[model samples]
Target: MKVFGFAGYSGSGKTTLIERLIPLLRARGLRVSLIKHTHHGFDIDKPGKDSFRFREAGATEVLLAGGQRWALMHELRDEPEPTLDDQLARLAAVDLVLVEGFRTTPIPKIEIHRPAAGHPLLHDKFPNIVAIASDTPLDVQLPQLDLNDPGQIAMFILKSVDLA
Candidate 1:
């Protein structure tokens, strides 16, 4: 599967842009899967839930299955976090994988930049950044995309990955 990524600082509209792009890509008959990496610790299981209890009881992995879906939660415990390729191996096959984060993972990515967010541009530091999407136009050598134009951004992503 082709892989692409979105990288930006917090509140830079990365999630919003991805939310808009998913449907556009799906409508084109492409199966797209996403892997979002967050710096914070998170939980999908609720406290007092069976899965939560099982995990607390020292289960290394807990699989919760329902009629429509299933989720496997593996406790890292003392294990080092898995690499991007390792995480990718756990996902089902799809035409494209849109990674939302893992900025330094070496995947081709679009740097989402909003000057109003008070952050410096990242494209220069990260050579893997193939383009920049911003709310305001900036003078940069790389291809620039309007952050408000999801359609245009979606097309660019497809073309970049050769999925168009």
Candidate 2:
């Protein structure tokens, strides 16, 4: 699958941009998949759910399947953290994969930035950033898009990945 990525420091608006970009990408007839990296642990299953209990009872992996949907939860208790490539391999199939983190990964990316976030730009350190989406313009030398203008941002992403 063709892959594009978004990276930035905390509060840099990566999630907001991706959330809007997904629908725009779908509108263009591409099957898009998302891989979001989280800094801390998170759980989509309820604490008291049967699957949760099973996992707590020493299940290494759990698959909860139903007529309409299914969920697969794997326990990585002592395993090394999964890298971007590792996670990407899990996707079944898609025309494009949009990643929300892994700024250090080799993937070409769009860096979302907010000056108010008081964080340095990731592109400055990682030249793989092919473009930028920001709340305001910067003096840097890169294609820039208004952060809130999801349409144009989507356009840039689509073109960057050769989808447009």
Candidate 3:
């Protein structure tokens, strides 16, 4: 699958942009998947649920299935965190994969920037940033995209990965 990523400091609207882009890409008849990496600990299971109980009881993996969807939760426990490639292997094939927050991964990415966020641009430090999506224009060498324009951003992403 063609993989693209978005990198930016928190509050720069990365999630919102991705959320907007998904439908646009899908409307173009391409299948898309997403991988989002977070530094904070998170749980999709709720307390008192069977899946939660299973996990609390030391089950290494717990899968829950319903008519609409299924989710597999694998506890790393003492194991080292899986690499990006390792995680990617678990997904079913798709035309595109939009990754978020794997800033160090060597994938093509767009750096989302909001001047109000007061954070320095990341493309200088992170390699393979093909463009920048910002709320305001900046004096950068990379192609700058309007953060509020999802359709334009979607077109750029497709073109960057040659999906267009």
Which regions in candidate 2 have their CA more than 4 angstroms from the true location? none
True-structure Cα RMSD, model 2:
1.3
Q: In candidate 3, what residue range of length 10 has the lowest lDDT sum? A: 79-88
Q: What value does the lDDT take at residue 17 in candidate 1?
A: 96
Model 1 misses residue 63 by how many Å? 0.8
Identify the runs in model 3 with alpha carbons over 4 angstroms from their true place.
none
Which has the greatest lDDT?
Answer: 1
For residues 1-164, write the lDDT of model 3, one tens digit per residue. Answer: 99999999988999999999999999999999999999999999999998999999999999998999999999999999887899899999999999998999999999999988799999999978989999899999999999999999999999988989
> Against the true structure, what is each candidate's TM-score?
0.98, 0.94, 0.98
Q: What ranking emerges by lDDT with the best candidate at the front?
A: 1, 3, 2
List model 1 lDDT by residue over 63-148, tens digit each. 98899999999999999999889999999999999999999999999999999989999998899999999999999999999999
> For model 3, which pairs clash?
none
How many clashes in each structure? 0, 0, 0
Model 2 steric clash total? 0
lDDT of each: 0.95, 0.88, 0.94
lDDT of 3 at 3: 94
Model 3 vs. true fold: TM: 0.98
Comparing candidate 1 with candidate 2, which one achieves the higher TM-score? 1
